[model samples]
Target: MKSGDAARLMGWDTTRLSRILRGTYRVSADDVRTFCGKLGVDDPAGVEEVARVAEEPIGEGWWAAYASRIGQNYLDFIELEAEAQTLRIQHPVIVPGLLQSPGYVREMITRAPTAVSPAHAEMLVSIRLARQAVLSTATKLHALVPESALHAKFESGPAIMRDQIRKLLDASQMTNVELQLLPLTAHPTYGSIGAITVLSYKHPWANVASVDNALGGNHIDDPQQVSFLEKEFAAIAEIALPVDKSREVLDEYLEGLRK
Candidate 1:
C-alpha cells in the first residue's frame, strides 16, 4: 500500500479524518455509526461519547489563561498532550518544544515571520515553558532527534544551542525520558520527513499523531495512518544511536560547538 491509501479508504485526507477522530468535527451519531461500521466495531455507545464531548461544556484549563497568546493549532496539541500517557517524538529540526529552554523558545518565536508583539511573545513563552509541567507528571516521553538538530544553529545562536544540548543531556538522565540521536547517515530516510509526535492513551481513545510542517499541522487518530507513522518512527529509532551512544554523539557535537 502507498503511504496515503488509508486516508483514501477512509474517504478523507488524514487531516480531516484526524479532526473527526479528534472530536473537532461536528460528530453526528450517524457519522459515528458509519465510522464504527467501517472500523468493524459495534459502538452506539461511542456515538453517545461523541455527543457528550460535543455538548458538554468544558471547564477552564491552564492553557485558557494564554489562549490568546497560544495559537489554536498548538492549543489543540496541548489538549491531547495533557491526557497522553506517553509521548514519542521525532524531531528533525530542533529540540522538541517541551524540552526547550525559555531562551531557546523565545528565540524561536521571535524569529517567526508573523512577528509577535513583545508582551504577547512573553505570554506564549510562559505557556510553552508551562507545558514542561507534563514532564514532571506521569507522561513518559521518548524523543528521537537527529544529530543535525543538535548541530543546527538558530537565531537563539550558539549559547542557546549549548544550553539546549545541556538540557537534552539532563533530560536523557530522567527515568521517564528516552532520548536518542539519529545519526547523519539516517537523514535521507527517517529524518528528512521532519517531525511527528505520537501520543498514546488508554484504549478506545487510542493513539494520535501530530504531524508538523512549516506551518502548524494536524492531529491524526485514524488507526491505520497512526500505525504507519508509528512504524516510520520505529524505523527512525532503529537507525538512531542507543542511549549511551546518543549521549556520546551529543557530547561530540557539543564539544564541536565549543571549539
Candidate 2:
C-alpha cells in the first residue's frame, strides 16, 4: 500500500507515519496500540521492539534507569519536536522547556516532589537543554507567557531571575522565535482551561498536533483531543497581545525589575 494510505489506515499523516517507520520519530504507546489494531498483531512484543528502536539511547549512567520508563509517548513527543514546522506554547506557571534558563530549571527541579531523585532531575534538565536545539533550526516558535510567570522568582534567587529575564530578552531577538505576554489585565479568557502546547507537523496528507496537559504532564495525540486543544489555543492566542505589543510589555516588566 502507498504510505499515505497506510497513514490513513492508522489515523496519522503519511510523512509523520513514515518518519516513525524510518526511526526519525518516536512511536508512542498509543501509536503502538493503533498499529497493532490495524495490523492484527496480538502480542505486545512487537510494540516493545518498536518503542525500543524509536528511543535511541544517548549517554550513559543514571538516565539509563529511567530509560525504560520513557514510553512511546515521550519518544513521539521528541519526534514531533524534531519535525514540527511551528510550535505554539501557552504556559501559566514556569517557563516552557525550550525557553527555560538553566538556573530557573534547576530551581524548579530542586522544589519538585521527593519522589523525583536529584539525578533524575539533572537528566531531565539535560534533555530539556538538548530539546532547545530545534529552536535554532527551521522551526517557527510562538510562546505565550502569563505575566505571573515573569514575577514568580525561583529558588535560585533574584539574581537568577534577573539573568533569566535577560536570557528571555536575548531569545526574543531571534526572528523565528515570537514571544508574547498575555497581560494580567486580560483575564477571564479561554486560557483558564489550563496550559496547552500544540506542535504542528506539516505533512502531505494532513497536519498532526501533540497536546500536553498540566497536572500529570501527559502528552495526547488523539485526533479529537488534539483538535480541541488547537481550537482552544486559537481562542487564547486571539486574546493575547500582538507580537510588537507583547515585546514592549516584556521590556517594561524587565525595566521595572531593574529599578
Candidate 3:
C-alpha cells in the first residue's frame, strides 16, 4: 500500500507514518496495535513482540544522563542488563564492572586509552557503581575472574587492590552472585580467552553477549555466537575454583596486599 493509504488506515498523518517507516519515530505500543489492526495483522504474538521491543524507553532511561558522554555500546549493555535474568561474565584481565569497587572503577576509567576529563571520569565511575545494583535485584550474576586479575598491578597503591579484593569478598557472599576464580594453573585455553559477558533474559528476548576489546566493547547478538560464548563460559566455570575456594583465594590475595 502507498504511504498515504497506510497513513489513513492507521489514523496517522502521512508524515508520521513515513517517519515510523524510516525508523525515526518512537512509535508507542498503542500506536502499533492501531497499525496492526488497520493492516489486518491479527497475529497477537507478532504485534506484541514488535510493540514490546519498540517501547523500551532507551532515550528516557536513567542512563540517558550519561548518554552523551559515554559510548552507545555501554549504554546498550546496561539497558539489557537491567532486564536480564542472569549475567554470565568472564574477565581474565580485570575485575568485572559489576564487582569493581569505586576506587577500582576510578582507576580503571582514568587509565583507559580514551582519555576523559576528570568530571567525566567521575560520571563513568558513578555509572559502573550504579550497575552493581543489579546484584541486589532478582538478577543473578555468575562471574569468572582469573586469580591473576586479583594481583594485577594498579598504578594506585596496594590500598586500591586491597579495597577491591574486600569488595569482591563481600560480593561473593551475596546469595544472588557466584564469583569464581580461575587458578593460574588452569588449562591454557581457559586462561587465554578474553573477557566476555553473556546476558540471558527471561523470555521472548534471546541471549546477547558482549566482548571487551581496546575499542570499548562489541555486542554479539547472533544466536549461534551467543551460544558459543555461553558454552565457553560453562567450560571455564568447570575449571574455576568453587565459590568457597574462590573466597579463600581472595582472602589470600587481600592478606598479601597488606604485606
Candidate 4:
C-alpha cells in the first residue's frame, strides 16, 4: 500500500507512478492488473472485475475498429466521454463536433487550409459522424458556442452553415440537451484560451476535461486545474444567453445565413 512498495510492484520509478496517480499519464491493461494485485484487491471477483473493466471496449463495434485512426491522447477522453453522465462543451469558432452535420463536417474537413488526402478526409468525417452515437439516451449535453463561431464561413458556403444551424437547433430541443451562446462582445478572457469540453461522471477518476488547439489537444486531470477550467466555463456561461433562448439565437443566425 506504501508508495515505494507500489512502485516496486509495478517496476516503475516513483515519479512514474505519481504521473499515473495524478492522471498526467495513462495506464495499460497490464498495468491495471498489476496495480489491482499489488493494492490487495486480488480476490478472484475483484481481479475479474478489474480485468473486465480494464479490457472493456469504450466504443463497442465500429469505434473499436477505428482505434488506430484516433490519436491516443484524444482517445483517452473519448473513453471517458462514452461513460460520462454529462458533457459540457464550449466552442469558440465552430459547432461542437458532437452536433455537427455531415455536410458541415465535410466542409470543415475538406476545406481546411491544412489539406488532407481525399480518402483520409472522408475517414475523418466518418469518425465524426460515428462519435454522435455516444450521445444515446438521456445523456445531458450542455453547449456554449460564441456568436463568432456561428458566423465563421466554410468553403462550402452558407448552405453548410445553414445545415449546421438546423442540426444544432434539433439537438437543443432534445429533453436532455441544453444550448447557449456567448455574444461576440462578452468578456474576452475565456475566448482567448480556446475550446474546452468537460466530461463529468459519478466517480472522480472518470472526470476530465479536453482542451483543443492548433497544435493538438490537452487532457486536464489535475483537480485544481480542472476546477479552474470549470469556473472559467461558468464565467462565460453567465455571459451567455439564457438556455431557453438558445433556439432563438441559433435561429437568428440561420436567418442571416439565408440572407
- Output the TM-score of candidate 3: 0.81
Give the winner by lDDT: 3
| TM-score to native of every candidate shown | 0.74, 0.69, 0.81, 0.78
Cα lDDT for residue 208, candidate 4? 82
lDDT by residue (49-139, candidate 4, tens digit) is 5555566644575567767876776566556677678888998778888998999888878888897899988988987787788777657
Ranking of models by lDDT: 3, 1, 4, 2
| Model 2: worst 10 consecutive residues (lDDT sum) | 202-211
> Which residue pairs in model 4 clash with each other?
none
Please provide, for model 3 over 1-259, each residue's C-alpha lDDT reduced to its tens digit, 9 standing for 90 to 100.
8889999986689998888888898898988888888888868887898888788765776777877887888888878888789999998778888999888898899988887898888888899888888888989999998787776677778889889999999999999999999988887788466898999875566899998876568889899999999899999999899999999888988778423
lDDT at 176 for candidate 4?
A: 81
Question: Candidate 1, which ten residues in sequence have the lowest lDDT sum?
Answer: 1-10
C-alpha displacement of 54 in model 1, angstroms? 11
Cα deviation of 166 in candidate 4 (Å)?
0.8
Q: What digit string (tens of lDDT, one per residue) describes model 1 on residues 95-170?
A: 7898887778888877778876888878778888888899998899999876766666675468888888888888
* Model 3 poorest ten-residue lDDT run: 250-259
Over 4 Å off, model 4: 3-61, 204-206, 257-259
Question: What's model 4's overall lDDT?
Answer: 0.78
2 against 3, candidate with superior lDDT? 3
